[model samples]
Target: MMKRLAMVFVGLMLIVGNAWAVPDGIWKNITGAPAYSFYMQTYVGNAMLVIVAPNTETFWVFLDADDNYTNGFSASQDLSGAPNSLSITFTSDGSALANMTLTGQLPATYNLSRNAQAPSTGDSGDAPTLISPADGETIAVPTSASPYSMTWTAVTGAEGYIVQICTDNSCTNVISDDNGDWTSTGTSISLTHATAGFDFYWRVRADLGGGSYSPWSEIRRFHVSSS
Candidate 1:
């Protein structure tokens, strides 16, 4: 039997305009895996790419914007001819609107689509409630191959979330996040640590951008067993 592999790729481009800078790029409709349709404006310079895969979860990589025509930008990858490693490249000069060009086993590619506008500052809503470990339960330590699955309820109108794991109830010693910030785009995240066998306190908040965030949720406690 052949092994199954799944992957999703998204890119964003930001250009300096007028008195401010504008962000544009490929935005994937979060309609699960095995099927995908993206939205974007003309493909220019300064691109951001987000990759999602099993176990690894969500990751974002960016290419800086260049205003000088002489300074061109580029990115490269070697998929090693994997089933999903279909090489593709697209570009636009911004002289006119352009659509995405996909070359691979991708489901559908849009050639005359409109820009997928970014969300503006909206309601911050309420704090996200912690859902795993049962608030005082003990769980096995997470390994590099497998990690504790931290999860929580989604907040209304939330663009993202800030998660904090600590050693004490006061949260004086902060635990490092392996998966970056658990972005609100996804409700669950994998958690891991080099050393375990410790008690951990955690809390979460809603990020509304522009220096605004929802109040932190009530802290929850959990213990990572040594065995």
Candidate 2:
């Protein structure tokens, strides 16, 4: 006696070894991107050699690192559809690559219309912010106890502020340049560094991000215990 058996295959939903893929040739389409993904349908066929399988379908798709498609399968795709091109984007990790995959197998020797411009930039990242005008007080100049003061324009995006003063023309000099004689006052930015009898140039810029620095201020000038 003969016996009957059943079998199962699954997902990616890919048909494999059966679906016809267009040769790696150049297909063309218009270029640009909308806020989200877009679609285009081009003939994926040879016309002379094969006919689309009855009730068969074709798709163009992209995938992610997890093998998930960026855009899903399209329904009612026809070999005669026009503007067979599109644009898309993906994450850096490729975990979300935009694609154009076709299903319902195409006729052998068919073509996949491709957009001249592949996908470009992904969704915009988190909004940026400005952080500092910072906290400080008692910014002094032309004094012995302390010397060095800086003022910055008001900031809007800034969450807070940071003020730095130095006795040198070049700002490359850090806190060490401020010397042991220094102080801060939070809201209104200011500082005083002990550098008696020396002419020091200074300036301040508002930092507009959470702990980020703003563009440096025009180098302002001042003196410590004046010459």
Candidate 3:
């Protein structure tokens, strides 16, 4: 039997323009392994690529544009701390090709076709409820102490949760955000980079997979005071 390998490759590309040749949405593999798919979305003036695979390690990379070009982009990074690289190209047509090279494996190409437009918003009722460090709550932090714990009520049928901490109530300035690897199945996470004497706003959303996410929970604020 052949070995089955799964992985999610997420790349953040900083580009200069509001237009893109490739549509932003979920792209399914038309040729090659049935497990390969890509989800592209534009966030905060950057393009984000999300590869969804089951029981796989997640890889993230930041790619800098090499030239003033549109319609296609490529990036190389180590997957799961392995010596592997991937290059993807998109065409004017609703199609894409991904070339991947993995250690001790033959190079392969996967053909992808546009599936659907990226989701704009998720169901509000599926949103997770914030639990810990309650709204307007004050927490004293010592110079040497464990990270602040942020907990929330889990949502049924949710594969994972995304926590975003911002500097404003409107969540325009996001300072910290974590998706918990999409398989953690945990309802809480620790904010290790929280600074003292500052107000932080946070919210939680459920990741329903297939490029769909639940609406963000109500914004909550907390204060971190120096001990």
The clash count of every prediction, one per candidate, is 2, 26, 0
Q: What's the CA error at residue 54 for candidate 2, in Å?
A: 60
Q: Compose the digit string of candidate 1's lDDT tens values, residues 1-227.
A: 11112223343222211011233432222322222222222233443232221111111111123321111212232232234534433343443233333455552333322224432211235778889867988888887688888888888766778787877897667766655544445666677663567788888777654323555678999988888
TM-score, every prediction: 0.43, 0.31, 0.46
> For all the candidates, what are their Cα RMSDs to the real structure?
14.4, 20.9, 13.5
Question: Model 2 scores what on Cα lDDT?
Answer: 0.32
Error of 1 at 177 (Å): 2.5
Clashing pairs in 1: 12-25, 13-24
lDDT by residue (tens digit), candidate 2, 179-221: 4423233334334335556554545444333222344445545
Which parts of model 3 are misplaced by more than 4 Å? 1-125, 142-145, 177-184
* Residue 69 shift from truth in candidate 1, angstroms: 39
Better-scoring candidate (lDDT), 1 or 2: 1
**Deviation (Å) of 2 in candidate 2:** 49
Q: Give model 2's TM-score versus the native structure.
A: 0.31
